[model samples]
Target: MIEQLQAFTDSLPPAVQWIVVIGLGVIPFVESYSGSVIGVLAGLPFFVAVPAAILGNVASMLFAVFAAHRLRGVVRGDRSEAELSPRRAKLKQRFERFGVAGVALLGPLALPSQITSAATVSFGASRNAVILWQTVSIIVWGAGCGALAALGASAVT
Candidate 1:
């Protein structure tokens, strides 16, 4: 799967490689970190890969957050308490224990920011707060992964 992802990324023109990374970054599991790493491994420069991945992840998360926020009331309206899954319950605990910043920052390690952001919003967190922290998380993760790729590339050369 990783080889396939790298191959697909490499098949793109260098001038628009970032676009491919952006599309990958928007996926839940792929996110900015993996997408940026794939971009770099596919021969994209750190400057192009990192920012594009972060932008894509952030854009998708923002959209999800806004949508969830808009529909929070309606979704929660008739839902029974018994419908909550163990995963949902865990996320709720994380929100209560860590608040928006902790959950947003650490969310990528456990789940996609898109999922976490939606869960956060559904749990009644402020939309503005989730966006702000999630942006920080995306940037940090993208940069970290990009740096790792640079180091790996250098080692190979």
Candidate 2:
């Protein structure tokens, strides 16, 4: 599985690297695995993989946050518009109740990384706060996975 993933990443051209990074970063499972695979394929050390993955993940999170903000405007419509629709109100309420941790961790598991990050931001969570927690989570998870894959690769070789 690891070798196959590595080969796929390695086959991609340099121009495709950014695309892969963004695509994997926005998605859920791919964000969790693609960075490590790319690192191994590129002949980068595990330490490098961890940071690269974290950066990709962070970029995705920022994109989501911006999207969520834009969605809020769309949902709210004009200032002259009376009140939020039932669905919009419900979403706002849910986000308000769940708070940052809900979106930061559980959201990623349930939805795409971008959606999760954006939802958290749309709910009026501080951007810095969300970024801090999400970055930490991404780094920790990416590092652990990268380290494990590197160790396994070394053992097999």
Candidate 3:
């Protein structure tokens, strides 16, 4: 399976490679699955892949941050129904009560990356804060995954 995936990614053009990286970064499931695997499949050094995945993930976080900023008014409409649901409302309130650090640490574990981005924005978090925290989370998680992958690659070889 790994070899087949490697062959597939290897056949793609450089532009497609970047697209794949970006796409994988944006999609939560793909982000989780590809975070480590894509780098290994690309035959990149662990250092290269780790940073690339972190950068790609950060790129996606940037997109979410900007989108949340732009869509803030739309998401938080005049009516309560137009806004996030009651459950999301409760979660946002919790984050608001606890402050940025709680959201920064627990958000990734509890929600999809994009949802967490949106939640932070909706909860009136500063754009810079969201970007900073999300970047940190992405780097930490991506590095951990990359290290595991590199270890596995070494073991297999």
Q: What TM-scores do the predictions have?
A: 0.82, 0.65, 0.74
**lDDT for each residue of candidate 2 in 114-134, tens digit (9 for 90 to 100):** 666766776667777877767
- Candidate with the larger lDDT of 1 and 2: 1
Model 2, residue 85: C-alpha shift (Å): 5.2
**Superposed model 3: Cα runs more than 4 Å off:** 7-19, 74-89
Best by TM-score: 1
2 or 3, greater by TM-score: 3
lDDT of 1 by residue, 1-157 (tens): 6456567767877757867889988999999999888878877779998988998999999999999998998768878767889998876776789999999988988999999999898987999999999999999999998899978976875
Q: How many backbone clashes can be found in candidate 3?
A: 0
Winner on lDDT between 1 and 3 is 1
For candidate 1, the TM-score is: 0.82
List where candidate 2 sits over 4 angstroms from the true fold: 1-28, 41-43, 74-97
Inter-residue clash pairs, candidate 1: none
Q: What's the residue-level lDDT of 58 in candidate 2?
A: 77
